[model samples]
Target: MTRTPSVSVVFVCHDGAGRILLARRSTRARDEPGTWDCGAGALEFGETFEQAVAREVIEEYGTGPEKIELLGVRNVLRPGSHWVAIVFAVRLDPAEARIGEPHKFDELGWFDPAELPSPAHSQLPETVALFT
Candidate 1:
């Protein structure tokens, strides 16, 4: 891969009450299979952060966001790859959330922020702190 970094729109979808949605990564996921994480996708060229987040939410969660709040940005660096993670907290209808991408995620769930699922993506804890 080239040394250039890409931009990713990472977001946590919530019910506006308290619970946040998470997806369990499947074996086909690029990394961290079996770990739970927020929804995310590449920032397609010419699209704004909100657009990317909205599109990703529907494509990943099968629901649209009622509200979107930018939490913060993160420079996510790993061994071989790096990306700029623009994080957001999105409010949506939890009842409509399902695993939109079956090849990438095997399961989906909503949990209290204080009691998120274990074996989370390595960056999850810090990312959650940016909002809650």
Candidate 2:
């Protein structure tokens, strides 16, 4: 069987202070429920990786890309599947960011780089390391 290829995005926002946005996954998600992850999601059919990243930001955070910088890409393989994620360094004014309804996430909040929560997944550590 041919496994489906998946793409995800990691959004990092900083203020020269040492913090990044992290979201708590909803229990309803198929995998890694309740884990803290950077804003991310799979690429939809007929969408470019960049388009998927922009769409995910709107769907999850209700914001558009105003000044997003491409960080790098990382390929990760789990036990049953693989992923290619485009990580981006994004800067959003805190005042303009409103947490969307928890349709896919239980909670969303910002965390200091030194105090990030545990159980990070999907190359999040690498993404964070790039920013810090």
Candidate 3:
């Protein structure tokens, strides 16, 4: 059976500066363990994009988004899978953000967009570029 493309909500949680938050996925993560990625998750059946963004951020970061703006959408197709991701620029106090899920993320940090950490998630660069 052919699987339908998944819908995801992505958030670039920024500190109102040029720095964006990235989390290093732990070994328990599905695809890219040890790779840095912005906060994202599959959108639940009844959740709105904004709601998913808020829920995912809080679930992953331990804090809520103070402000969220729709950036754009990305249609991603890999060899055997696809997804449409609705991206958003989320502003939150960097101090308030922490690793809420230790099993999912090993480390989290804020970095300059121009100097992102190594071993980043494959789609992170392009997904981040959509903000500008």
Candidate 4:
């Protein structure tokens, strides 16, 4: 089997207030089911990071970002996969969020940053730290 690293646009959406949006991974998710996580998607061919973020936000949350800000980048390595994570903090309207991808996410919630849900995604801690 041939393996290659992929690039992902990882984003956490906020309302410009103190609340951040998270999705609960469904059993059908790629990994870490039952865990709470921010949104992410593979970068499409010829697409810029910003373009990927916008597409993913609409796909995952059914909402568009009001503002997108670059956070940082990380080389994410797990047991079977590796990715270059391009992180972003996106501001959006809280009222418009929904579980756009039913197979991947079972729930969507707006949470206070300090009171996040239990059993977070493996990369969540590092990703959340970049929100500021």
Candidate 5:
């Protein structure tokens, strides 16, 4: 079987306590529409892992390179494809960072480390654990 490879980026911000930024995907998305997800995308032909993560953050959240730190990576296989997510930690002023438009994300918000919402990816809990 041919495995489809994809990339995902998780943004964690720390204030007094840490919070994870979660996005609600649009209903028009090919997969998992209307579900909550982290900022993510697929790797292009010539892109490096860091480049892909950086690109995704900018594309999804308008974040720049200076704002992020690569945390680690996680490999998750679901059904027919494998996802290699490049995890990242970005410290942002919650009051300054706002969700951008024109992305698949319909809604955006910050969730406490222990209080994530439902319809979130199955691997998200494990992914978040690594940061704490």
Candidate 6:
């Protein structure tokens, strides 16, 4: 039996200015260890898109979304995983953001769009570019 492509919610957290929050993947991360990436998670079976985005944001950053907008969608594919990502532009208080899941993320920071950190996750640049 073949498996179906899953759904994921990718949120770009901004401070309503120009700084976007990014988290560095820890060595124990599922993929792309030591790479900076936006907050993301699988879309649950019965949850709405906004709900998924909000949950992921809070779970990863210790903050909730103040405002959320549907940016666009991207079809992400790898050797063993395929998913349609629902991209979102979320606004939140940067002061309330932290590494909620330290086991998965090692560092978190707010960066200007033009001065992003090096060695970002393979899909992060494009994902973030969509909202820019």
lDDT of each: 0.91, 0.73, 0.93, 0.93, 0.69, 0.93
lDDT of 5: 0.69
Candidate 6, poorest ten consecutive residues by summed lDDT: 109-118
Tens-digit per-residue lDDT, 32-131, candidate 3: 8999999899999999899999999999999999999999999989888899999999998999999999999999999988788999999999988986
Query: Model 3, residue 58: what's the lDDT?
Result: 95
Q: Lowest-lDDT window of 10 residues in candidate 3?
A: 123-132
Which TM-score value belongs to model 6? 0.97
Regions of candidate 4 where Cα sits further than 4 Å from its true position: none
User: Model 4: per-residue lDDT, tens digit, 1-132?
Assistant: 889999999998999988999999999998899999999999999999999999999999998999999999989999988999999999999989888899999998899877779999999988998885
**What's model 1's lDDT at 54?**
94
Give the per-residue lDDT digits (tens) of candidate 5, residues 85-123. Answer: 777776656665456654577887888878888788666
Off by over 4 Å in 2: 15-17, 45-48
lDDT of 6: 0.93
Model 5: residues with Cα > 4 Å off, grouped in runs: 1-17, 101-103
Determine the C-alpha RMSD for candidate 5 after optimal superposition of all C-alphas.
Answer: 2.7
Worst 10 residues of 1 by lDDT: 123-132
Summarize candidate 6's per-residue lDDT along 35-94 as a digit string, tens digits.
999989999999999999999999999989999999999999989889999999999998
